[model samples]
Target chain A: MRVRVLYFGVLKELFACPSEDVEVETGCNVGALRKVFHGRMPHTAWKSMAIAVNQEYAGDEVLLHEGDEVALLPPVSGGAPGNVPWKKIILPSPRTV
Target chain B: MQIAIVREVIDAGSITAALKAGADGAVCVFDGIVRDNTRGRRTLYLDYEAYEEMALNQMRNLAEEAIAKFGVRDIAVVHRLGRLYVGESSVLIAVASAHRGAAFEACRWLIDTLKKTVPIWKKEQFEDGAVWADGEPFPEEIVRG
Candidate 1:
């Protein structure tokens, strides 16, 4: 089986590409696929990364299928720190009042 | 709820105005912009990228969850990709609700959760060099062994 693997964030720099098609043995799960990359990069690099199958987060036990879109997601940093308040505030709900 | 991942600049004012409803008492907006500096280094620009399809999916899920969890009436989340100069709006999140509390809570929660879960990455181009910004660690449940 083959899967279209995607690299995001630093993984793109590490892998030197945005995406690629990888050949994996049939019935291989996400864990097995991760080991393939583990051989390339240091073990610490894999510690915080997450895998997404078909755009949804998947566990290691999740089996991969042919042509599945697997994404290597590094810790995400999306939003900017606006002037919004950082302190957690819990206001009384109108209903509760 | 309106959730989108756009390449063009995000228009925060218009999106916030569009989300307002007669029944809503408040609309909280979080407009995330590119800062001019990181630490002491001067930032030239920022290049943001994402797994588009997956990002959209994750954003939509967050919007829906915010509505249910915080009782926000509606939400519009738009994140821009490609190169963005300093002070440019990189992402916009607006939450509408009948009460101000819900709107405020939802708006904050949406941005916080999106930063952690969304498959978006930012590369900072400093005046001296360029590097990928370190991302916050993923939630434990999302990390695969």
Candidate 2:
């Protein structure tokens, strides 16, 4: 089966392309697919990437079919106002308490 | 009308206006801009990219969830794509409600949630080099399951 794999951010830079068609065995799972995907890119590229099939995050054992839109998502930096991550911080001791 | 992933500059005025309606006491607007520096590094610009289909799906879901959870009357989320210079806004959100508290809280939750789950990525270019910004890790539940 062939999967249309998409890349973004660091993954795109690592793979040197935005997307490509990947060939894999029929009945292959995402975990198995990772092996083939990683082989085509630099070693470090897969360290932090998460796999998404057709937009939803997929677990390692998720079965992949032909023509699936798979993406290699890198560590994201927050974009837009509604696109930021939250950080927990301990504040300096307060005076009013 | 409520969610958009655009390449053009974010129009805060229009977005804010879209959320305003009669009887709403306050409209809270949250804007995320491209600054001149990051961690003391001089930033030249930023490039944003997204898994458009997934991003839009996630964003609209978040907006609906915010309305249900926060009881906000209206909410708008807009994220910009492509190259952006310093001082430009990359994201903007507007929330309105009959009271101020829900709008403010919803705005905060919207940004926080979007950062973690929306499939958007940003690359920061600096004077010396460029790199992708490190985002928060996915929650254990999402990552493990």
Candidate 3:
């Protein structure tokens, strides 16, 4: 399977390219894909990065399908007003945008 | 107007009018201007970029959530990309509601959330050089290994 991977923000700077298509085994997971990225950049900067699949943040266990869109998001720096944690600020309805 | 990631110069005046409603008594606006300095560095310009598809999605989500939570009637968020010199408006958010409280709360919430959740990144260009600034960190739960 081939997954289209994207890099944004500082991750784009680290990857040296915005996007690329990577070959992965069928049903590979995000952690496995991270391993691929880790192999490419095994320095301290690659650590603690997040991954998003199909526009939603993904956990390691989430399985990847063919042609799936994956993104590497850098460490975000913004927060809710007055240091409010984002997890506590739940939306009343998670509507599809 | 409503929600946008534009490359053109943002017209704050038009956006302010766009958020106006007859029923609303208060309209709160937050204009995130690019200053001439950051941490003592003389910033010459700034460059913003976003994860286009995901950015729009998150922006809409933030607006809808604000309306539901703060009871605001209207919200307009416009962000600029590419190179912007100092004293330029990098992002603009306007919230309108029947009362001042909701409008104020929504405006504050919108910009903070937009900075954190939306996949937007900014690079600060100084007289010496440039550096990318990652907005505040995402929640620990969302931060994957």
Candidate 4:
């Protein structure tokens, strides 16, 4: 079987490409596929990366089928830091009566 | 709910205005902009990228979850891709509800959750060099061994 694997964030820079097609065993799962890259790329890079099959997060147990769109997601940093006000209000301590 | 991943500049004011309803008492908006600096380094610009389809899916899920969990009346999440100069709106999130509390909570929750879960990445271009911004780790459930 073959899957279309996508690279995002630093993975794209590391892989030197945005996406590619990879050949895997018929019954291969996400873990097995990850190992294939781990063998070639720096092991540390794969440490925080997650897998997405057909645009949804997939666990290692999830089976892959041919033509599946797999994405390699590095940790995400999307929105900017929000200026949310402090949640807890500080009150004066009660004086001894 | 309105969810989208667009490459063009995001119009924050219009989107927030569009999410308002007669029954809603408040509409909270979070407009994420490209800052001119990162950790004291002068930033030239930022280039954001995403697994487009997956990002859209994740954002849509967050919007839906915010409505159900926070009981907000409506939501709109829009993220921009490609190069963005300093002060440009990179993302926008707006939430509407009958009261201010839920609106604020939902808006905050949506942006916070989206930062951790969404498949979007930002590359900061500094005056001296460029580097990918370190991302917050995914939630434990989303990571696979």
Q: Using DockQ as the measure, which candidate wins? A: 1
Per-residue C-alpha lDDT of model 2 across residues A1-97, encoded as one tens digit per residue: 8999998877776667999998888999888877777677654445556788988888888899999998887655666422333221212332221
CA lDDT, every prediction?
0.83, 0.78, 0.76, 0.83
Q: Model 3: residues >4 Å from true position, as ranges?
A: A42-44, A76-97
- Give interface RMSD for all predictions: 12.3, 9.1, 11.8, 12.3
| Worst window of 10 by summed lDDT in candidate 1 chain A | A88-97
Candidates 1 and 2 compared by lDDT, better number: 1
Candidate 4: tens digits of C-alpha lDDT, residues B34-83: 88876676878778888888889889999999999999999999999988
First chain of model 3: TM-score? Answer: 0.73
Candidate 1's residue-wise lDDT over B61-115, tens digit each? Answer: 9998999999878899999999899899999999999999999988888888998
Mind giving the per-residue lDDT tens digits that candidate 3 earns over B1-145? 3998888888989889877979999989898877777656576766778778888888888999999999889999888887787777778899989999999989988887777678777666656555666456676777766
| Chain B: TM-scores of all predictions | 0.98, 0.96, 0.95, 0.98
User: Which residue pairs clash within candidate 2?
Assistant: A80-B91, A81-B91
Which segments of candidate 2 are over 4 A away from where they belong?
A38-44, A80-97
For all candidates, state DockQ relative to the true structure. Answer: 0.29, 0.24, 0.22, 0.26
Q: TM-score for each prediction?
A: 0.90, 0.87, 0.86, 0.91
Comparing 2 and 4 on DockQ, the stronger one: 4
Candidate order, TM-score descending: 4, 1, 2, 3
lDDT tens digits by residue: candidate 2, B1-145: 3899899978899789877889899999999898887657687887888889898998999999999999988888999998898889998989989999999999999988888888898776666666667577765444532
Considering DockQ, where higher is better, how would the candidates rank from best to worst? 1, 4, 2, 3
Docking class of 2: acceptable
